[model samples]
Target: MRFIINILCCILAFSSCTEIKKYHSIHAGPKPIAVVIERNPGIRVTGSETPLSVLYENGTLIYSEQSEADIPFYMKKELEPEDFKILKNEICMTEKFKKLRNSYNLCPNILGSTTVEIYMSDGKNSKAVSVYGYGIELEKIHDRIPYPDKNDKLPDEFRRIFRKLTGLNFIEAEKWTPDYIEIMIWPYGNAPEKSANWPSGWPSLSHPLTRKRGDSYSLYMPGLEKNDLNDFLDNLKPKQAVLINGDKWSVDCRFVFPGEPLWMKAFNKMQ
Candidate 1:
């Protein structure tokens, strides 16, 4: 009878484990639990880039930074489970952070600057803050904008939270490999004098997969080959236009980091 009871217990335990695995595989991929994003309207006119930092539910952290030469670099690291637990507890359990109001939007500086946003959610209590601090390069025209000429400082508590999430001093990340590359294309015209020649193997403007996005069209390049991400994007930058098939075209490359849905078209809503 004792042997039979032990066998039954093992069967039940295995069944429970199988169920949990199925649920995780289907529902709990690395959903974006938090992100630090800075959008520069000055960059592409419509403006987009990788978020500065993204913290995922499964302990994944993705970071992107711009080099002194204006080149972009990306890296990723998986936090220790215990470290992620502590960070999540700090964010979710703190009443002040949980109760803070949603937005702190101010207009960016003159000549062009955009909003910086921080968003965190533990499934239920979500905090989204948008801040546009005063730009030191302000001109008289700054007074003419919709936002105030002088921006108010964020309260100290919120300031520390922002710093903590962004300051990944402990994390050491490897090169980021994106799941997809979203390329927004505009027709050839007024092209920059310094432009990268069209890359071979890129889909044509009218490729079947190209979809109309407002005035322009978009194409996605999947990172199939292990080295495709670095190999394909090496010479391309939004600063320089592209001459494709003998025509000058504007191109914006936006990284689609893992676990986040299709380029986050609703990204502005987070602000």
Candidate 2:
């Protein structure tokens, strides 16, 4: 009787393992209809850094940046179905990607500079992964694998999957420029002793005075010319704002430009 019981236990264990394998194979297959990648470069002393968002859905791709009001300035393009199919296949074949853990913090602190969040859905099932810092080192450390290079941006498998999915190399999308630029300025650490002075070299405006809302101020500058925007960006000094805050705090400034989705809403509001 004891010998028979041992045989039954082994069979049950084997059956359970097989079921687990089958479950992963079915759920991990190519099924994502939409993917969104949000990249945050983190804060820098210069305060000139901006976050980026890339969205892929139904063969359409969009790259965007966020404004102060949480509006997005975007550039969009259409993609081929074949290319998307290739990306889906690559992702499904990655062993580590079978069912990503809900969350991962490769490095809790220290040398982290960027955070990437990936969201995917197939109109039925969905998965999300938040990668903190460069993924290469984190993935290795998490899996107890030796790191060949500390500076590697991502694991080989992930790099390939992202390259195919994002189409970073194949982007031939048209650039989108805004008709007018909106600027928002606010205190970062401490309230300013007095009103902050506008940077010099900015185009003179009939209403250059900033409008106060709560503790922050906003300025609207009208210029659609590419060169004009470039000049404004070049002259704007984030470091100066940091100094104005007693060198202890940084100024929060957001530059808003026109783009899809939000662009239409902004235009309608103007009209």
Candidate 3:
């Protein structure tokens, strides 16, 4: 009777494990977030390249200065098709947060709309105002060395991958003469150093040369897309919610920036 009891216990344990696996697989997918850009205004454009800090809703800064600090969180656009598989394999081998694979998937809603507030002091009028609201998209980093010269700011394959994964278009800006060029791109975190085509020190680094702030880099690029600009302005959450209530908010700039034209169209379309 004791031996039969042991057999029954083993059967129950195996059944429990199988059921757990089925439950996890059923819930294995990414979560979606509703991202809207409420307000965005143009500012006195400067050519200086500076790495800005991105703060999350919880105020937990999800970025680190190190290259590999938060690999999974940073490289949504950089991962190749096969690299994702390799990442899973590595996680399985290490068993470090292996259960997390079932719990989390990288979704666009995770990185909410980013508001860019610039404190510009022209030695006279010191003011802090909203500049741009960076929309969520997988952006490709380029090299500073070939600014206004690189044939393709973003490679076709990379753009295709971003579209497939994010359901958003990764628009490439044409070459333009801008001061202080900085280029940083990402590769599949699992497959780093694949080719010399990629830039060094992606997502975070010591200087502007090493920093790449998502699709924010695209704003500085030349060509503008209707959706990209629209998405950007929507993230600002502008205080211009009412017009007749005598809520006359002052705009930072008299004229719109070069990129604002496309963004303005997007805003009007939503209205």
Candidate 4:
């Protein structure tokens, strides 16, 4: 009887210890990333009531994506790609909004086409469906080139902005490529505008809001959806006043020292 009692005591102690250590393992559960999509404002179209299905490499149910249709109130004339230009190929969701840092798991495979389909309707009379193209080989943010600055070093401006915007800090810019570092920034809150940390300039000639700086560097902002960016910024009130890479009206701090309070908590957690 005494032996059995002693064993029970040890089991109880172990259970108690595990309960106490649960908080330390918060990052263990379902550390997954999501692929979010939004209705295109330029199309003046709304989404269907039924949730859309997402397929992986060939035919695998990854996630059920559903979105309500949102069309512009103004009249949209039948415009060709060259008439009233627009960016039809843009991702609504990014990896920055998740707890897990490994987004490649949910993204396209090493070399394959990732399909994103949506059911959209104008709610009034026109109801149509469109399937967007998503391929892992393209839209890669990992390509890295020399910093525009003479030092040939990566810029830390984005790291500082990450701290200010999401209270998250990543590896040094020198260590990460523009593709490896996923960033989403907003110039103002509740405004329909936000930009990602893309290495290449927005596809110009198609996207008017984008500007090409030099042979190597390009600036892309206007082509991005404004409302989506604004909503993200509005949620993080603590990061108000923080700028991502700076604005045209202001000098870019890409070449400056640490400007914001780098969040060591996230860095330590990630490591």
Candidate 5:
């Protein structure tokens, strides 16, 4: 509980702070060395939202994943020193990523195509690159590389690093909970005859909850604990229609860092 309070204090103090400051607010926690996000920015199933994985300096990895299940959750694993060392060595040795520009063609307007965004930071400096139509078989529209760093496929060096980082060495991981779970709710037009009533202690849906960084509306369930959230929605299923305020609303939820709002709002504003 005290740890949660610290996280909150860090957030409040750094509220509206720069992206780097906010990203590293958890003082005692390891700073993220790499982050891979398969961004769709649209509504998602309970456990299948974007922001694929975050790997930290201390070899700790936290990621969002669930298999054919509702009520999304996170997993945490600590890598061995040698394993982390090898990964870090490879990232440091890779020169192309550093030379490449900060971002590629974002393709934000095009729907249904997943954009892969990679963020790498070494405590002092950070680089973020976005790949358009990642994981899709895309042929280059033009032979010449365009300015502003556009690429048809994931670059070789970047792909190598991405694969290694995401290829987790350990399969045994414990469930990890973040400080907050963000939820977006909107009235469902075709709610079924039988649906779970909104949990009593959960936030009120009628009251306007602020929308978040992406295309949809999302809000952090303030002071909502993991156990309570799990207990509240245990009976629900993915795409389960929720009834609240005498109206039906579909709920989509994802985990958020304490200061995620700062970057999230910026993302909403970006192309």
Candidate 6:
């Protein structure tokens, strides 16, 4: 009789443990420490688009632009937990939403697609949504997920949420431009070393060389106008020939415009 009672008690304990596990799984909420929104500004004549990125983390908001010039300028502001409540609610980072998003197929042939990525506090879990065209599809999916109909315009709710989070109206391109322009120069392939004596006709601007790799260098030229940049490029002549370790080498100039902070950070780490 006592053996039967012990067996029944063990079964009851196992069932209770299973129920507790299920309850916690269903009630778990998203604990997001940081959120990043990134998108291209649009196609340019140069066949390159500048990227706009907004990062919210540690109660601070940072807006970064890498369009007009090489170095990106960051504008930062302090934020409170309340500032993110609306965005968090709108993101709806739950297991069900993630499953639906993963199953949904993003529309192809999209012109100027935007990628919105969210990162949780643990940094292991993340969710991403692709916005095609003007984000009509994104709105539709958000409005009627599990079965959404396509639309032409972005949802008003999404626009409001983004504007509040980034403090910029994305609808207007003119508003995205900052007052200052930044320029960066990267020299590769047996580039000439800096001269100890300044050139006679050299432009009086700060050109600090940041090493990129073995025998390569990057220079940062900040706060310059269009005319100033044009003049500098016109006067700067490519090295005709270079002698490295008794071998004749010719240098080529290639400009790299990093569209995202990730690339920029990687470049900064070189050397």
Which candidate gets the maximum TM-score versus the true structure? 1
Model 4 lDDT per residue over 1-271, tens place: 9999999999999976764453223212211111222223232112211112111111112222112554211111222353212211111122222222211222222233332222111112211112222222222432342223332221132222222222212222121111111122223433333433322342322343222333222223321344443454355434233333443111111100010011112122322
Summarize candidate 5's per-residue lDDT along 129-176 as a digit string, tens digits.
667666322323322434334324446776666666556545798877
TM-score of each: 0.67, 0.44, 0.17, 0.18, 0.61, 0.36
Clashing pairs in 2: none
What's the candidate order when arranged by decreasing lDDT?
A: 1, 5, 2, 6, 3, 4
Q: Each candidate: RMSD to true structure? A: 12.2, 19.1, 25.7, 23.2, 9.0, 17.8
Residue-level lDDT of model 1, residues 1-271, one tens digit each, is 9999999999999977875553233223577777767667667636455677888878887776567997767778888899889877775426776665555545434445555666676765556666665222322254465655365545455566666666774446687866556677787576556777766777666654555667676666664542553554565665666776676777766766655542243355653
Sort the candidates on TM-score, descending order: 1, 5, 2, 6, 4, 3
Q: 1-271, model 3: which lDDT tens digit per residue?
A: 9999999999999977875563333223322111112122232223221222111112111111223654121111223446545532432112222111111112323334333222211223222222121222223322322333322233332223222323421123122221212222222223322222212322223332222335222112212232343343344343322111122211111111212222233233432
**Model 1, stretches more than 4 Å misplaced?**
1-29, 66-70, 92-94, 105-111, 134-151, 170-172, 190-197, 206-209, 224-248, 259-267
Query: Which of the predicted structures, 4 or 5, would earn the higher lDDT when compared with the native?
Result: 5
Report, for every candidate in turn, its global Cα lDDT versus the true structure. 0.62, 0.45, 0.27, 0.25, 0.60, 0.39
Local error of candidate 3 at residue 142 (angstroms)? 2.3
Backbone clashes in each candidate structure, one number apiece?
A: 1, 0, 7, 10, 2, 0
> Cα lDDT for residue 13, model 3?
100
Candidate number with the higher TM-score (1 or 6): 1
- Report clash pairs, candidate 4: 44-71, 46-69, 47-68, 47-69, 141-179, 142-179, 192-226, 192-227, 193-226, 193-227
- TM-score for model 4? 0.18
For model 4, the local distance difference test gives 0.25
Model 3 stretches astray by more than 4 angstroms: 1-9, 21-156, 164-271
Predicted candidate 6 versus true structure: per-residue lDDT over 71-108, tens digit per residue? 55445444447855654555434444354332122334
**Cα deviation of 129 in candidate 4 (Å)?**
4.3
Cα deviation in Å at residue 19, candidate 6? 51
Q: Name the regions of candidate 4 deviating beyond 4 angstroms.
A: 1-51, 65-182, 186-235, 238-241, 245-271
1-271 per-residue lDDT for model 2 (tens digits) = 9999999999999977875553333223222343434344554322232224333345555455446997556565566789766655555334565455544444554463454545444444545555556432333354563434543334444545554444443347655553444455555554344333444544223243334446654445543544554554466455544323232223343433222222222222322
Report lDDT (Cα) of residue 204, candidate 3: 27
